[model samples]
Target: MIGDLLLAWISEAGNGTIADFRARAAWLARTENLDLHESATGRWLRDASALGHCEVDWKHGKWSVAPPVITRLPLADGLAVLVGARRQRLLRAIDEEGVYAEQARRLGSSRDIPPPCTILMPYERTRDLEEYAAALGAVYSGCAAAAIAALLGTTAPAKPTAPPAYDSPFEHLSSFSPQTWAPTLPSRPNPSEGLHREQVNGRWQHLLRREGGWYATDLSRGVFAELARRGETVIRWRPDGDHRTRTGTVIVDWGASLPPLQARALVLCSGFVPRFGSAAETSLYDNVPREIAARVASSLGQTLQTSS
Candidate 1:
């Protein structure tokens, strides 16, 4: 079935569409003795999704797997070139185990370029058509093959690793040095011309009239810093009601509370009540973790002990 083929392709190739997958399943059944019927295929795919493998669909043009699979199987022996290419695009829309393996293709490819401190890829990198294509191909050809081989009962020798606590797959990501980074703040609105002007740094310093003339702080900065310090490198942003709170608290996906064990942090700024002011106040939050609760409790304990 179509779903079976897609699942096999996803399992074997990492991603595939209905037609492309069906064609491959037909070929594999006929040649490789892989008994993947349509019903069986769908069942396998459902199983794969339940087990956390991402389902990827490509709707562009017709494609063939026989030739490329044969041609690059040796030199580019590990990656899932075809599925990797298409899968990265899907990563933007679907969280799929939260890592978004397809999108991480570029970060692996551009290992030289220091990654930005944010979760989402920069607009320029994500929008670049050619770069995305290359990333897909690289991932497909590099990793997909090894994944397939492992599925087919082939085993490669394992590599050594550092200690468990010290072993972080994304340890390289933390090597970022903000000193070498150049700031690119968005342009601010001009009250004089009644339009957005080149004003920047709209943090706590910027006074807002819409906020009842209350000077606002950029809560994102504080949150980001806090999470980073706590080792939560990934975060998602959610806005709070302006009437309720000036800044929003950070939360994990699926409405989970911010974990004391920080892995990542995200900043949300929706429904913030704005106040009109002479200067802009956009630098309040930096979206990093601050460990405020622990710090506050520690200070309170010290004061109580002194008084007693």
Candidate 2:
């Protein structure tokens, strides 16, 4: 169940423990289609701990879930599965019906389809953290909520003719405007550096050696842009081969989406900067659908770069 995944993640976190995991918990709740406020995260964690799923030690500021040595315990019904199923059925029907209808009309259906470009949420005043967080989670929330709302069709948040800009969600995020929005190439590193792997988005991505000589990711431009925006200078990410990457000296946690780029960029709650760069010009992960791009960037620790 979704809740199980959330708990499992926390349990599998560094040292199999989570210290001060509020923001990430909030974001996870949204993705699971739970209308949970940030404050609710603690209650949820406590409830899970009480249920014998995890151990909560507030004094030490940690939540720990010790996996069963031999057996997996079943969890209760997590959320509204009926709603999720219905949405999936609807999407399938839409595609099937559209294809049949098009074929009847003697039109061809392309196997490769660019999803309908509809704004799920447009520019709106930051009324509250929930709304802002929801916007960031429009895609992440899946069919349980955000995607469901988008499928039902909603009005754009801003005027159709003019797109909108957004405030960076983090107070520490960079606020300076660039003389030129274009990315400055990442600084060079010593010749010893090379491509390495790092744990990101629940998986691993390569930290590549850039032309500038520094070991960074393929999407370094966007990552750097997000860091500068947040006024951050260093990325404390885990690389497969680097001892520093494994050390707790620096830790990264994915936060809310990059408001300016939405899912195109996402911040790490711990660092208050982007976890990966999102490519802008190409349709790829550097060139792919927004959803796929986000996943690829997550696995690889990068997203496409775009300007505000």
Candidate 3:
């Protein structure tokens, strides 16, 4: 039950995809308040670990639940999600394959139940049919997964994949390079936006929601922060406008690259500055501060230009 509870806590923290020590400690304090008073709490953790219900990452000091065995089956022609009984047969079929499959139920588990099935494919607008499921049948599982067989498979032992690759969302600023990237502006919007509580992946993160947009991943934000530091600027969007419209997260276009960014971002070299927005006077050529422009280029924030 401890393992089950711990896994749930971990999952709930980061999009339910990851759990760290601080989160675990906090979760323990919250759910097992009585356990804290007992010295045997440590022994319980040891026992849980010995049973292979979970594993400890010593260096990082975190615990990780096993991830589901994702057996990729082409459902539709485009990406569509499966829900309810609509997702059952395929799940059962996959489960019958072997022990590596994840189960939907378990013992010694009061809270966390493993995911039954997860399918990703293109949507052809005809996926709901039972015939459709049987027709396009080239499914296989190549990923290293856990739960090792059983529909009642209780524990998920595999670790989640590493943080996604970093792609800067500020990749579009290269177009204005020939110019001074603009000379000046009346006010500059602060970049960091002063860290706020944000949900990332499936967990509670203290990062901004500059994302959910393609370029707003943690890696991108961190890179943006670094680049901003170099140029002494932070990468952020213009949150305020006449309509009070919420600009969805900032994004960099698909084909944009880094060279142009380097040219425009380097202060010492032949680079152009970036133009960002602010509270007071919005400038025609919003020259982003050196700090922020540098961060955008270096971090690859991949910010795009909107129509004037």
Roughly what TM-score does model 1 have, to 2 decimal places? 0.17
How does model 1 fare in lDDT?
0.26
**lDDT by residue for model 1 (101-212), tens:** 2222112111121111111222222233234334333222222222332333101112222221212111111222221212222222322110011223321221111211
Q: Estimate each model's TM-score.
A: 0.17, 0.22, 0.20
Q: Tell me which of candidates 1 and 3 scores higher on lDDT.
A: 3
Q: Which candidate leads in lDDT?
A: 2
TM-score for candidate 3:
0.20
What lDDT tens digits, residue by residue, belong to model 2 across residues 218-278? 2233344344334443323232233322212112223322222222222111111121333
> Higher-lDDT candidate among 2 and 3?
2
Q: Give the Å shift of residue 69 in candidate 2.
A: 5.6
Clashes of 3: 43
Q: Which 10 consecutive residues of model 1 have the lowest summed lDDT?
A: 299-308
The C-alpha RMSD of each candidate to the native structure, in angstroms, is 24.1, 21.7, 21.7
